[model samples]
Target: MTATTLHADLLGRQDPQMADVLAGEARRQAGTLQLIAAENFTSPAVLAALGSALVNKYAEGYPGSRYHGGCEYADLAERIATERACALFAAEHANVQPHSGSAAVLAAYAALLRPGDTVLAMGLPYGGHLTHGSPANFSGRWFDFVGYGVDAETGLIDYDEVQQLARAHRPKAVVCGSIAYPRHPEYSAFREIADEVGAYLIADAAHPIGLVAGGAAPSPLPYADVVCATTHKVLRGPRGGMLLCGAELAERIDRAVFPFSQGGAQMNSIAAKAVAFGEAATPAFGSYAHKVVANARTLAGALADQGFAITTGGTDTHLITADPAPLGVDGRAARQRLAAAGMVLDTCALPYGDQRGVRLGTAAVTTQGMGEDEMHRIAVLFGRALREEPSRTRTEVTELALQFPPYGQ
Candidate 1:
C-alpha cells in the first residue's frame, strides 16, 4: 500500500478518547509559541517513526543481536541509527539508549567514575542543569560535587578560577554545560584544566548539539573524553539521550548504558533518532542552525533594547537569559504574563541574589518556520506584556501566533 493510504487507514482506526486528546494538543501547539530553552517540536516524519510498529518488538540487546524473538527489523533499525549518529557527530561510538538527557549524564558518570569521587560541576543557579550537581539530584547524592559559578562581574564562566578549583579539588571529572548560559565554554581551556588536574572532561552539549553538528558552534567531540546530549532540544528529534565517546572507551560506555543503567532499549526512539540524524545531515539543517543562533541574538538585543539586562551581555547560541527587573517585574511575573500572552518561557533564579531571570530560546519557533523578524516581534510582545497588563498584550500576541500555525495540524 502507498504511504498516504497507510496513514489514512491508521487514522481511521483511532479511538474517540485518543482522538480528542490528540486534537486538543494539536490546537494548543498551533495557538502558542514555545520559547523554552530545553524544548523543541519534532518533525512529522520523526513522529511517524516514533509511533511505528517497531515499538512492538522486545529487542533487549544491541543491533545484530537480541535476547528476545522477532528482532530482525529491530536490529536493522538500531544499526542504521547507530551508524547515522556516529557519522553526524563524528564520534567513535554512539549509544542511543539512556531514555532521557538526565539518564545519559548518569550513565556516563557511572561508567567513568567511582562513587564519592570529587566532581567539578557548574552551579545550578548559574545555568547548569540539575543533573550536573544540584544537591537534590542523584549526582550530588552519589558524588562529591563541587560547584563553580560564573564570574560575578561579568556573569560568564571564569576558567582561571575553574582551573584553580580543579587543582585544589582534584576532581574525578569536570562537567560543563548549561540550560540558561548564553555563551559557549572554551573547550580547549577546559581540556587543559582537566589535564592539569588529572581529571576527565565531560561535555554536555544537550542544548547545542544541533548547532555543533551544523558547524554553527564548536564541536566538543575532540576535546571531551565523553559527550552526552538530548536528541529533542536543538537536534529536534525524539525525546532520548545519546552517549558519544572515543573508540577506546566505547565498550565501557555501552555496558554502562545497557545492563548497568537501563533494561530493554526504546527501539522506536532509536528509529526516530535515525530519521532525525538523516534530516540534520542536509545543508538546509546548517541554515536552520544558523537561523536559530541569529534569532536568539535578535531576541536578546530586542529585550535589551527594552531595558532588560541580557545575561552574559548577549547570546552566542540558541538561548538567552535575561533579568526582568527593568520592567518592574520578576521572572515569575514575566513568565506568567508571557504564557497568558500566548508565549511560553521559563523563570529562573540567579545564583547569589534574590533577582530572577527569564530564559528564552528559538529552537521550537524556528523549527515552526519563524525567522529574525518574528523573533523580534515576539520580543516586542514580551516587552509590552512585562511593562503593561498581560490582558492587553495577550490579544496582540495571539494574533501574531496565528500567522504561522504549528505544522502537521
Candidate 2:
C-alpha cells in the first residue's frame, strides 16, 4: 500500500526497526537525567498535536489567504497558534511560520536587512548561537556580523564596548540573548544603545522565554523591535520558531517568512505550539520556571563545593557553564562518562577557550519534579562520574531517577 493509505502508526507497523531506534531514545530519556541546556521533553499533549492530521496539510500564506486549497482547518490552527503566541508574550503581532530557530533568525534578517548590511550580535563561543554570527554560518557569510564578547574578568557582556561598536559600525540590527549565557540579559541597556544608533534591537530570547513569561527574567518585548524564539527550550513547546513584533512589522515579517524564507508551514508543530503556550500560561508553569533557576543555583553551588570552576562564578538562570580543568578531565570525556552513568549533558566551548567545558541545565529535572536536594545530589554524581568510580554513580543515578520518573511512574 502507498503511504497515504497506511494507518497513523505506519512507522511502528511497517518500519519496526526505525521504530525501535525511536523507542530506544524514549527509553534513554526516561532512564537518564537530561541536563542538555537546549533540550526539553514536551508534554504528551504536544506530542499528540504533532502526530495529528494537521501534518498532512500544507498552508503557504497567512491564515485568510492560501496558495493551496483545503487549508480552511489549517488556517484556523495557524490562527489559534499565532493568537496564543501574541497573548503569551503580550506582543501586538506574531508570525509562527518559521520551521526552526535558525529559520526564524534568517527570516528576521531578510525582513530588516539587505545583503552586506552590518549586524552586531554576541559571539558564538561567548554563549551566542551559530545563527547569531559564527563565521561558518550563513548569518556571517550573508551579512557583516560584528560579534561582541563577554568581559574577560566577569563573563558578562561589556555594554561600553557594545556602545563603542554601535558608534563605530552603526550596525543595522543589534542582537541580544545567548544560547549558554547564564545571566539575565541587560535588555534596557541594549535598548538604549540601539536607540542611540537608530538600530533595531532583535532579542533572541530562545533559551529564556519561559522565564521571561513567568516573570523570572526581564521581558524583552517592550525593548525589542523584533523578538525571535525557538519555542522548544524553556517554553517547552514543539520544535519550531516564531517572531513577535509590533503591528507595523507584522505584514513584512509574514512576507519574509512565507515567500522569502520557508514555504508551506508546519501546521502540526504550530498546533503543538498553541498547546504548549496554554501550558506555559498556567500558575504551575510559573512556579516550575522559578524552581528551574533555583535548582541551577543549588547545582552550581554543589559543583563549586566539589572544586569545579563555574565560568561565571554562578548562574542566575536554568543553566551553568563550567570548566573541567580543576577536575583533570576533558569536557568531552566528562560528558561521555556522565552519559554512561545515566546523567546526560553536552560539552560546550567557553569564551576565549576551546571545547573545554560542559554546559548543563535544570529545566528538565525541575520539570520532572526534581528539587534543590536533587540538584545537589546530581552535582555529586557529576563529580563521582568524572573523578571517581562510574559504576557507583550510575547505580545512584538510576535509583534517583526512579523517584522522579520524567512523565510518570
Candidate 3:
C-alpha cells in the first residue's frame, strides 16, 4: 500500500482532516529544504518506532520499580534508550525521560538548586535558549539569572569576562551552549570557570548531540556536570529530551525528572531515541556528521562571497549565522523570502545587537545525503532570492531539492 493509503487506513476513518494534514506535512518535508538548526529528518526505523504501540503504555516511574503494571515493555524501551544514550556520548548515566530539552534543563536545576539560586548563562539575544536565562522563561522568573555575551569585534565568547562574572556572582550553575551561535563551545573552559566559582556546569548540547556522538564535535559529558539535549535536532530521533551525567549524580537527576518535574514518560519517543542512538554509533553516521560541518563552512564561505556578512567570520559547526543586511534585506524579510522560494531557515537575533541575523544549518540537508556542492548551490539560491529574485530562485530550489529528496522519498 502507498504511504497515504496506509496513513488513511490508520486515521482517515476517524479523522480524515487530520490525516490530510499529516499527508500535507509529509509532502512538505519531502519537497522543502529544512535548514532549521534544531530540525532533522528521522530514519524510517525511527518513524516506525515513534508510531509504535509503545505510546499506549503509561509507566509513571523508572524501570523495575514502576507505579503501574504492564510496564515491562515500557521499562525495556526506556532502559535501552538510556543505555544507548550513555554509550553514544560516553556519559556515565543517561535519563531519557524528560519531555524536552527545556524540561531537562528545568529538572537539572530542580535537582541542584533552590527557588532563588543564582544562574549565569548566555542571554536569549546572545544565542542562549529561553530555558537558560530569558526573563520571560521559568528559568529567569524563578532564579536570579546573569547573562554573558560574546565580544564585539571578535564575536567570540569572552572567557575572561565569564570568569569575572562567576567570581563575582558565585552562581549555582553556569550554562554553556547557544541556539544561534556559529561556533563550538569550549566546555573544558566553562568547567574550569565553574570549578573556580563552585558552580554546577550545565551544557545544553541540544543542537549538536549527534555531532558529539559521531565525533564531529567535542562531547560535554567529560567536562560538564550535566548535559541535556533534544533527540530531534541533529540526532534524527523523535521529539524528546535526554540528560546525561556522572554516576554520582544519576539518582538525583532521575528523581528530578520523575516525581519532581515530569510524570509519565513518552515511551514511543524513548524507543525512537534508542534507535537513533544506535544509528549514531555507526561509522556512517560519523561521516555524515563531519560532512554536515564541512557543508556549513562551505555554505558560509559561499554566502560571504555573495556579499552576506557571516557571523563570527565563519563557523566550525553545523550553523552559519549571518546578518542578511549585506544582501539589502532584514533578517525577518530574508527568512520570509527564503521560505517563499521553498527554502526554510530562521531569522536570528544576535547578542546585545538590535540588528537581525539569519541562521542556516546543514543537518537536515546532510540527512538527505547532500554534500558541499549542494551547500554551494543553496547559498547561490539564497543570494538570488535575497536579491529580489524569488521566482527564479524558487524554481532552482525545487529542482535542486528533487535531486536529494529528504528521507530518500
Candidate 4:
C-alpha cells in the first residue's frame, strides 16, 4: 500500500491519536522550511528499514556475541551496519550501536579516559557542542575540560592557541570539531599538536561525517585516534550514532559502548544506518553532498545581501551562522519571527560576543530539490519575513514549501 494509506488506514485503525500526531508532523514538515543544520530527509528505503521487523530484536552484545538468544538476524544486521560504516568512513573498525551522537562521544571518552582526566576541545561560545565541555554536561563534570576559542578577527580556529593550550594543559585528548564553525578544520594541524603533547586526537565529526562519506569534505579517519559521528544529519539515516577507530582500539570502544554506556542495540536503526551508508557511497550522494554546500554558499551570500552579517563571511559546508542584528532583531527574536513566518532554524553562540546568531543549513531544502535560485528566493523570504507582517510572509513560505514537497506527491 502507499505510505499515506498505510499511515492513515492501518495506523488510524488502531491508534488514531498517535497516527494523527504523525500525520500532522508530516504535514508540518512538508508545509514549512526545514533549515535546521542537524536535520535531513532520509530516503524511503531508510525509513522502511527503520520501520522494519528488526525493531523487535534485542541483541545486547556485539555481533556473534549476544547476551540473548535468537539473535542471528540481529547479528547479521549489526555486522552489515558495522561493515558499511567502516567502508563508508574508511576506518579500520566501527561500532554502530551508540543511540545518539552524544552517546558515541561518551563511549569514546569512556574507552580512552578515566574520571577527572584533563581534555581539550572547542569552547561552547565558539560553536562547540554541549558534549565538548558545557558546565551542565557530563564532559565538564567528569573531566577537566580546557576550551580553545577561535580568532576574534578571523572567526577561525586559532591553531597556534590550540597548540599553546595543549602544551600547557597536557590534556589526555584533544577534540577537533564544532557545531557552527562553517569551515573544515585543519586536521593535520590538530594531529601534529596532539602528537607533540602526547594526547589522543578525537574527531567529533558528527556534523561532517556525512559530507566526508560523500566526498564533499575531508575525512578525519587518517588523523583521529577515534571518530564519533551521528548517522543522521546529512547522512540521511535513522537517528543513531557510531564510532570509528583503528583496530587496536576496536575492542575498547565496543566494550565502552556496550557494557559501560549502553545496552541492547537498536537493530532497526542499525539496519537503516546500513542503508544510508550504502546510499552515501553512490555518486548520486556525492553530487547531492556538493549541492548541499553549493546551496549553503548561495544562501549565505543571499542572506548577506539582505543585510544579515554572515559569520566567517560565508560557509564552506552545509551550515551557516548569521547575525540578524542588521534586520533589527537579535537571534532569539529572529528565530521566533522566522518560525511565525513558517521558516524553521536555530540560534547559536556567536564566536566573539555573548549575542547569539542564527544557525541554518541547506541539507533539508537541497534534499527537496531546491537549488541556487531557490536559495536566493529563501533569502528574500528571510528579509520579508523579518520586515513584513508574519501572516503575509507565512503564506509565501507555505507556498514555497508546498512546491517542493519532501516526499513524492
Candidate 5:
C-alpha cells in the first residue's frame, strides 16, 4: 500500500490533542527501524521530562550556587542529575551540562591542554569523531593533533604504532575512541602508551556508555583521566552530553563546561538524565545491554555470510559497519533506499577507506524490544536490499518490516 494510504489509516484515529502531527511522526518512527549508530528514540518518560516545567527556569550555575534567583527547585534537579551520573559511571565527579558530546570533548580538551599544544589521537575516517581532531573542527584548528591508526592487515588499532607516535611526538594528551570502529578498544594499551609519554588519556565512550554501565563493556573510568559521552544513544536518555573525571580534575572540568563552553544548564534534561541513570543502574538494563551486543553480532555474521566485509570481522558492541560498495550500493544510496522502506541507518566512511561502508547500531531497536530473531530478519532485509535488484528487494523489505512493526504501535 502507498504511504498516503498507510498514513490515512494510521493517523485518522489519533487523539485530538496532537491528532494531525503526532500520528504522522509516529507512523514514520513505527514504520522504520532506526539503525543510526549515534541516534535513538527517547522513552516517553524522558520525553516528558524534556518538555516539563524545568525548562522554564534559568539555573545559570551549579547546584546551590547559582547566578539567578528562584533556583531552589532547579538546584534539586541538578544535584540529582550530578549524583546519579557519578553513580551511573562510577566516577568521582560528573558534569551533565555540556549540550553535546562534541561540546564535552571540546571542554575536556580545553581543560587539559592549551591552544597550539600537541596531542595524540585516532585519525578521522578511522573511527575517531570529528571533534577529536578533524581539521574542520575547532579541536584541530586550536590544537596540534598527531593521529595514529589501526593495522592495515588486522583491521584493528596498532598500539605499538601509537606508542611510536607518542614517543616521537610527546603530545600533551592522547584521546582514545571511535565513531565507526566495531572492535573493543584497548584502553589499557592506550593508558600504557600515555603513561610512557607522560600524556593524559581521554576515552570517548559515547557509544558504549550504557553497555559499560550494564557491566557488559569495560569501564574507561578506571583508566581514563577524563571520559566524555552523550546520554541519549546507548544510555537511553534525553539528548545531552556529560563529562566524568577524577576528583583532582573536577574543578577544571566543571569550569570548562560552564562559563567556558555554555551558559545556563537545561534543568529538564538533567532531570531526565537522572531518570536514565536510575534505569541504567538496574539489572534489567544489564540484560538489555547483553542482548544489544548479541543482536549486533548476529546481524554482523549474517551480513558477512552475504559476502559483505564486516569491519573488524565482527562487533564487540551494539554497532556494525559494512562495506556496501561490493554489493553495488554505496553507503549513501543504501541508506536512502533503506529509509524509504522503513529502516534508518547512516552512511559512513570506513576506518581507512573512502565512504564504502554503512554503519548501523542495535541500541535503539533493542531498547524497542527487538532481539536476535528480529536481528536476523533485519539483516536479511539489509542483505536483500543491497544484494538483489532494487525493485525486487523493496517490497520484500517493507513486508519484513511489517512483521516487526514497531514498539508502542
Candidate 6:
C-alpha cells in the first residue's frame, strides 16, 4: 500500500495521536528544505522492509549460529545484507549488525585495540566525528588520541602534519574520515602513514559510503584495514551501520559487533539495509550519485555568489561547508534563520578558527528530483531568508519544496 494509505488506514485508525505526530513530521519533511548533510529520503521498498515482521525477531548472533531460536528468516535477511554490502564495496567480509555509524566505529575499536592505546585521527574542530575521540565519548576516555588538522588557507587535510603526528605518537590505529569535509580523503596517504607507524588504518566512512556505492567517491575498502559506515545518508537506506574488513578480521569484527558491543540485531533494519544496497548497485543509482556531487558543486558556487565562504572552495562530494559570516550571521544564527524560512541544515567547525560554519548536502534535494537549477534557486532563497523577513521567505521556500515532492501524491 502507499504511504498515505498506510498512515490513514492503519496508523490513523489505531492511534490518532501518534499518527498525528508522524503525519506532522511527514508534512514538515515534505514542505521544508532538508539540506542536512546526513539526512535523505529512503525508498518505499526500504520503508516497507523497515516496517516488516522481521522487526519482531531477536537474533543475537551471526547467521547460522544464533543465540535465540526461530531466526531462520532473520538469518537469511542478514546473510543477504552482508553479501550485498560485500559485493557493493568490494570488501572481503561485511558485517551489517552495528546499530549506527558510531556503533560500527566502536566495534572496530573493540576488535583492534585495547584501552589506553594511542590513536591518530582528524581533530574534532576540523570535522572529525565524535567517535574519532571526543572527550565526552567512550573512545576518548579509553584511548589516548592525537589529532591532525587541515591547512588553514586551503581547508584541506594536512597530510604532512598527519604523517608527523603518526610518527611522533606511533598510534595503534589511524582513523581517516570526517563529518563535514567535502572532498575525497586521500586514503593512500593515510594508508602509507599508518604503515610507516605500524598502525591499523580505520576508515570512518559514514558520510561518503553512499557516494562510494554510486561510484562518485573512492572506496576505502582497498586502503583501510577496517571501514565503518552508515547505510543511510546518500545511500537512501534506513538508518543503520555496517563494517567491512579483510577475511582475517571477519570473525573478530563479528564478535565485536554481536556479543561485545550490541546484542540482538535489528532484523528489519538489516532487511531494509539489504534493500538499499540492492538499489544502490543499479546503474540508475550511479547516475543519481554523480548528480548529487554535481548539484553540490553548483550549490557551493551559488552560495559563494551569495557571499558564503565555501570551504575547500568547492566540493568533490555531496556535502558543502560554508561560513555565513560574510552575510553578517554566524553559522548558528544562519541555521536558525534558515529554519524560520523553511530551509533546514546544520552547523559545523571551520578549518582555521574557533567559529563554526554551516554544513549542507544535496542528497535529499537531489533525491527529490531537484537538479542544478533548483540548487541555484535554493541559494537565492538562502540569501533572502538571511536578509529579508523569514516569514516572507518561508512561503516561497514551501512552494518550491512542494514542487518536487519527495514522494509523489
RMSD (CA, Å), each prediction: 2.6, 3.5, 1.5, 1.1, 3.7, 1.0
How well does each candidate superpose onto the true structure, as a TM-score?
0.96, 0.95, 0.97, 0.98, 0.92, 0.99
List runs of model 3 lying over 4 Å from the truth. 1-9
Please report how far candidate 5 places residue 23 from its true position, in Å. Answer: 3.8
- Candidate order by decreasing lDDT: 6, 4, 3, 2, 1, 5
Q: Give candidate 6 misplaced runs (Cα > 4 Å).
A: 1-8
Model 5, CA-based lDDT: 0.83
| Clashing residue pairs found in predicted model 4 | none
Error of 3 at 34 (Å): 0.7
> C-alpha displacement of 256 in model 1, angstroms?
0.5
The residue pairs found clashing in candidate 3 are none
lDDT of 3 at 111: 86
Compared with the true structure, the alpha-carbon lDDT of candidate 6 equals 0.94
Better of 4 and 5 by TM-score: 4
Report lDDT per candidate. Answer: 0.86, 0.86, 0.88, 0.93, 0.83, 0.94
User: Which tens-of-lDDT digit does each residue in 1-409 have in candidate 5?
Assistant: 3332433554466654455565567666656677888877666677668878998989998987899999999988888888988888789999999888998998899789999989898888777889878989999899998988887766799888999999999999999988888887889999999999899999998898888988889999989999999998888898889999999999999999888989999898898998888888899989988888999999899888776788889999988988877777788888876776567888777766766678999987887788888887777777776665555665765565555544443
Please report how far candidate 6 places residue 74 from its true position, in Å: 0.9
Report the CA-based lDDT of candidate 1 relative to the real structure: 0.86
Clash count list over all predictions: 0, 0, 0, 0, 1, 0
Off by over 4 Å in 5: 1-22, 389-407
lDDT comparison, 3 vs 4, better candidate: 4
lDDT, candidate 4, residue 337? 93
Q: Mind giving the per-residue lDDT tens digits that candidate 3 earns over 1-409? A: 3333435567878998988887778767666788988898888798889889997889999999999999989999988998988888888999999899999999899988998999999877778899987778899899999999899887889999999999999999999988987788999899999999899999999988888988999888889999988888888888988899999999999999989999988889899999999999999999999999999999999999889988899998998899888778889999999999999999888655788888989999998888888888888888889887687777778888777866454
Q: What does the lDDT read for residue 45 in candidate 3?
A: 91
- Superposed on all Cα atoms, model 2 deviates from the true structure by an RMSD in Å of 3.5
Cα lDDT tens digits, model 6, 1-409, are: 4334545456887898888887778888889999999999999899889999998999999889998999889999999999999999999999999999999999999999999999999989999999888999999999999999999899999899999999899999999999999999999999999999899999999999999999999999999999999999999999989999999999999989989999999999999999999999999999999999999999999999999999999999999999999999999999999999999999999987777889999999999999999999999999999998889999999999999888887
Runs in model 1 deviating more than 4 A are 1-14
Q: Rank by TM-score, descending?
A: 6, 4, 3, 1, 2, 5
